[model samples]
Target: MKLENMVRKVYPNLMPYVCQLADLPIEEMKQALGKEQVYKLSFNENPLGPSPKAVKAMQEALLQLNLYPSSTGDALLARIGDKEGVEAKNVILSNGADEMIILVAQTFLEPEDEVIIPEVSFVQYLASTHMMGAKPVFSPMKEDLGVDLDAIIERITPATKTVFLCNPNNPTGTVIPADELRAFLKRVPENVLVVIDEAYHEYADDPEYLSSVEFVKTYKNVFVIRTFSKIYSLAAARIGYGIGQEELIEAIHHVRPPFNVNSIAQAGALASLDDEQHVSESRRINQFGRKLLAELFDELGMKYLKSATNFVCVDTGRDSGYMFDQLAKHGVIVRNLAGYGMTTSLRVSIGQPEEMQAFAAAMREILEKEEK
Candidate 1:
């Protein structure tokens, strides 16, 4: 038998989308850039090390590698319940929040089903929908980069299976304030799911920010996703969770693989939750870093979006592909935006003092060279 003939052929003509979906991102380009020790600000990864306590816990957990982790992940579930003020029955953990997003698509979407998303928010929402052969409907942001709630409300139809609300939205960093969120949710079709992704929530200190954890109990259609990656500095661990009603949680769990989360990740996440001091300091440093970047961008005469998340999107008024390459020459690596349909912008993640200083120095060099 010809091996090519034996291949599963679901996507012979449509395979490019799946291939490009896993294509190398800007952060991944660092390895091939020929830099021995480049500064990485492309991915909004916490530059700070893991909490001392979490590090210690992971070290101790290494010895227990012979045993399988708690299939229920009770300790991690209990900790999340205590913090979010919900019982363990209402929560489910995954390999990462991305996993939950995928499962949500699998649980609700049929081919050609409509999924509503903010035009400029997380791209994964679109990717997940398309993976299931569904359609994406978008409500583009206004000039300030904030979600236009009225625009979103206008698009809801009986075909809409879910609407992803990435408050403190990715790439742009704008948030949906409490009053606006309340109004939008009230009008959404009851049959559709609302995925409120708060991956960067711990970094969001705005008192007016209403995390969806509170809405889960009230709305049967609401699914709230949280990640250990941002504030907890657990990106490498790949553990995230969702909160919703009992039936929804059970439905998603059916599609999840047994032991989808590995042992070490569960241990580190459990420890990281209790590291209040680390979270506090990370927030403080992130605020300071935000201020520093704003001032630098102003001095350079470039326009930039104000952020509620850990990264800021800046408009360089030049092709971002050019800016990305020039900065790479000087050992500074920030995210290129051509993939986001922003050819004139780049995103910089908040970094520690020295990292920020180095990035600023490299940026100043690039702009000065351009002026000549």
Candidate 2:
């Protein structure tokens, strides 16, 4: 039998995206532990839970589960446009921003085309580029773990088609400043698409952090991908979007599957968008939790990166595996960065105030017990 007919074959090119490293595996852990009282701080979800407005929206949307989602989602697109000062014609919603990244790659990349991303940023950019049979180039982070703009500029070449800069990057919680990003964008080849994945934009209160929404309007090569997951507490709902020149968005839409986002996500995201009180409360809680975690790290003499996002990258100064296990025994889960190649580090999503307090107590016990 021919190789194509002898047996079923996997898409060799698309396996990377298909085999996503489960960003958080605590759900499986929850199963193993028989549903004990656990504090789930592993996935960096908003401990505040979904917005009150969004909960109401989902409850209302339950009546329509029998019907297919409005794939066009023109109304949500319009709401996004009104908020971002863009035309609805320029926006495209997807299952989540990860899907938007995939859409861009599928629509634009060709075999051997080069995609560039930060050395220690979101892993999805690498997966998206690889899925298209493309080469992914990395711009190494500086000593402080922020994107090294100079390294990025050095890597630009004729084959490059896409460049993703994840502002306030994951696994490190570092961001490229406004002036640096502006200057870098000026030098980037206009022929290549530049994507700023601002999934954590809502948590970024730094005055110097620039939202690329305005840049997308000014530069045809620019695209801004944002998600409802982070601050809106809608990760389970999976609503995200991309904004860019109308022509680029139209092209991306060609590869998007019909009805990719379900009815519940659309309705919940729309309601969450208008819940300013919930958003404010979330920000306040995140700020408080972040500070408390920092203090605990200081008291323990453990070093950590000060974050502008909801999670913190703590240098555990020893193998992270033991502490990770110990914390699980304490029922307070966190992200193990060893998979991200930070063998001595762990990433903890700031949870509710009491969860934070309990986590601090657990940390003391683990460290003390380990030392003993």
Candidate 3:
């Protein structure tokens, strides 16, 4: 008669996705630190904020809040199709890229199926796989913390249903080269699905980096996921989408919830497409901030990954938990990697120049105090 017995068998064994360390609200953190200003660089948000056009569109769309939005985000799909050079039929909209990950698992994963996941990539991929009662096969990353495409290909078995690839992967911020990924795709069995999570796609400027959207055009099994949360500064709106072959998208529609994306989010995302200037400026500032952070890490004699995304992962040569607490006390909040089994590393998001300078000063002060 216990409610716990009614829950799915997989629910008890699954681990929650932990993306942040500090539990306190910003106001509470400020009060505790006794600081006038706190720089939250824990989340990889667009430092420039949301686009003006998107904000204006969301404001105008507010008048129609009483009505439900397009059940499938038809207009936004059309615009995304135009941008990605795919037909409207090739895309599926979701509450966020996170939900799309879940929907894909719901549609394709059988209880016994196995999903190949990079060892240190986004935690949601593992969470989603477990939700469907699927076996998750962890593929170890290379020594440099880059996705090991070759190793993943070798791990494929007949039971493998899907392979999750996070391009310019979260935390590590490393990307698999286009040639290597193409080669990997060719070797993968057409029957197995490849879910490419490209949440940080716009931030990657490396010439070798190729969006999996190109693969989606030719490979019926390749599904590319993207979001407005990262570059469009619409993290709060929670709008994300997936691109794949028309048939693949059609299959996923069976599990999609009605009116999943709200009206204001749709309007903002639609208008964000036209705001090329804002996108460009955001990318520019990210590039500048990344370079500055890399230089600072170099000067500090810390080992850090060469990032292709908006955040950089650096080894602190001390307990990451301690580093996180000290930095938080100094009004600089960064991501602690303890949840990911990385005890001596932290992931710092790219912020504005002034914010980055604040982080730099905080680091120097902390290291000096430790030396003393």
Assess every candidate by TM-score: 0.93, 0.93, 0.97
**Best candidate per TM-score, number?**
3
lDDT of each: 0.85, 0.86, 0.92
1-372 per-residue lDDT for model 1 (tens digits): 986688544234233444221134445554667556677788798878689888889889999999898776888998999999999989899988899898898888998689999878887798788778888898878778788988988898889889998977898877788888888888888898999999989888667688988778888999999999898998888999999999999999888888888889999999999999999999988999999999999999989987888998999999998888788787777888787688899989999988889889998998788679
Which 10 residues in a row give candidate 3 its minimum summed lDDT?
17-26
Candidate 2 lDDT, 1-372, residue by residue in tens: 676676333245444323222243556656655556567777789988898889998999999899998887999999999999999999999998889988999999987799988878887888788778788898888988878988988999999999988887887887788999889889988999998899999999877788989798789999999999999999988989999999999998899999998989999999999999999999999999999999999999999997889999999887887778778788777877887677889899989999998899999998888778
Highest lDDT among the candidates is held by which one? 3
lDDT of 1: 0.85
Residue 330 accuracy (lDDT) in model 3:
81
What's the lDDT of the predicted structure labeled candidate 3?
0.92
Better TM-score candidate (1, 3): 3
Pairs in steric clash, model 3 = none
Candidate 3 lDDT over 16-49, as tens digits, reads 6443435455677677778889898888989999
After TM-score superposition, what is the CA distance of residue 166 in candidate 1 from its true location, in Å? 1.0
